[model samples]
Target: MMFDPFGDFDTNGYLQNSLRLKDPLEVKESEHLAFEASLEDALAYLAKRKSIDYKAVLKTHEILFSGFYHWAGKDRSELVPHLAVFKGSKDDPRHTIFERPDLIRRSVEYALELAANKKRFRERPGEVMGQLAFAHPFLDGNGRTILLIYMELCYRTRFAIDWSNTNKDDYLRALSDEIQNPFEGHLDNYLKPYLLDISSRDEWPEMIGGIKGLDGLDKEGITYDNLDNPEVQQLYKTYRSQRID
Candidate 1:
């Protein structure tokens, strides 16, 4: 089943988009265009911030996607608090489970806390990325939103990722493994070779927008269930008890 948390797909599309587009292809084109247009505004917003917190994360999503999504800045916790979102199926042992709605901010906050230790963040950027990706704060635009935030964090920390040098499928596989088996450095190993010196903030809009597969790490084949559902509750146990060597 598709992840339609809004429960309006039959009439409104995967999301209640700006132009009421019901076709997936059309919605994607329009949404991608809006995202391209907003990159500068989003970066400008981040550039003004003296410090970042969970609230800054929300605002960055708003600026980047408010043109396309009516529910742009709001997270799943506020919009669909009872639903627990996942990739693949809840019953599958291999599925990717995001943080529960109630814990979304806490997860992002933890990522920010980890980022505060600049040394740890630089040494294990994948761990930081994995944590934020697990937060899964928004209904859409997550990959781009998180990239912007991650870029800001990198800029502040004096390091950068050579995104162009990485492969999408490999990066995503590593990220999924990282979320499922966190702190063991699965993603860190994947990202280490791509780490490089920081680039100018002004170069980001063109450089990031020109890149391919930025959205590949985001929503696709997603499904959701009531938090009270037994299987859904069981799946969260993996996250609750996660630790890896």
Candidate 2:
């Protein structure tokens, strides 16, 4: 689950970072630092936006991680259309199968489509989140990027979740379950209790900067396989069947 998508881990470090840091801890430190520096700007940028789309989503990822990853904004379709990304060993029952490269855009668009109905989105933010998480558009920085997009969606809709109160372990568990069982309200059930009136965007810089484990899903248990693998192909078909429309 090292996520050596570029196959240059030994020489260029994880995802060929700017400093070529090899240790996972070093990589984590560098990424989190970069994420913190960009959080305020990212929040402010979202504050000005009237709406967001896949381009905005990619831009958010670029803004947050460009300092760490040269290919920060590019999605899987552009970077590695031939490989499939997963959260665990492909054969494992709990492993996650992200959207295929060709369908990544469709996945995000669908999430946005769901968010268009602000009332429904307010009630079932998890469905939107689960869709984006399933897309897994970027090689890295996906969790943080999607959070920014999700925040903007929440702000536009005038609602928020108390990330401060939510346990990272429980949230991730619900997200994983939600991804596997899309539209079943797994994430909505978990998030409903934490829903509250939206907080000031000014408070977000510190609040988001203080939240831990934003990278929990990104840093570990990531592996990739060739799209041609029969098992991998079968998994995509299964998940595609679950996709609405």
Candidate 3:
């Protein structure tokens, strides 16, 4: 069996759960582990996809036990929006991320509005990603989910935002701005650097290379050089490294 780094036996999910609980033991540790793994995988897959499909989103939780808590149990008909409801208990530690239910709904609606207006105006993808995170929709995986969704949207619509250029401080500033003035100032500020980078046609090969390899590959495919512009010897090395008969 493929080993899951954040699985039932680990505390990664439990740590997240402890935030909302007065007594951390209130949450079932086993269930938290299972859900955490599923959520992480879903976020990772969504980040890599070119476009958002409700089908793929739904499938992310189909096999999990408590996943149905958020989605209507066996009700596959209702589409899951890229930014949607987080149905964890308020008393649970998970509530820390989403303190107000109204804010969650507002964030979802705002994200939908952003998506709808993406083509009408030249909006930076990073700005949208930042706004989604500000929404903090999901109790657990809001950051991961929003980033993936924003990237996927940009990849399909041709407004990719690479965070490689800016430091974490700048990125967080943009997100903070969105919370204060989501309609105008903050969104643009956070996204401006990323937008400039995208427009400039600069590539950050190292960060892209370091991304986790496609699932099931024997080699992780993480290397420092630009594989796209590999030297003759490097090409030969890469060719030899692949599993071949």
Q: Which pairs clash in model 3?
A: 19-93, 20-92, 20-93, 21-93
Residues 5-61, candidate 3: write the lDDT tens digits.
Answer: 123225333323333222333444443454455644555565465555434433443
Model 2, span 147-237: residue lDDT tens: 8899889878888878888998899899999998888889999999988887567677766765667754586889898999998888988
lDDT of 1 by residue, 1-245 (tens): 33477888777776788788776667777888888888888899898999999899999999888998989999999999999988887677788898999999999999999999999999999989999999999988999999999989989998888787788889889999999989889999999998888757867876696666774346577888899988778767756876433
Work out the TM-score per prediction: 0.95, 0.96, 0.46
**Could you tell me the lDDT of residue 84 within candidate 1?**
92
The superposed Cα distance between candidate 3 and the true structure at residue 102, in angstroms, equals: 4.9
- The deviation in Å at residue 20 for candidate 1 is 1.5
Best by lDDT: 2
Q: After superposition, how far is residue 89 of candidate 1 from its true place, in Å?
A: 1.4
Q: What are the root-mean-square deviations of the candidates from the true structure over C-alphas?
A: 1.5, 1.5, 19.5
Candidate 2: list runs displaced more than 4 Å. 242-245
**What is the alpha-carbon lDDT of model 3 when measured against the actual structure?**
0.40
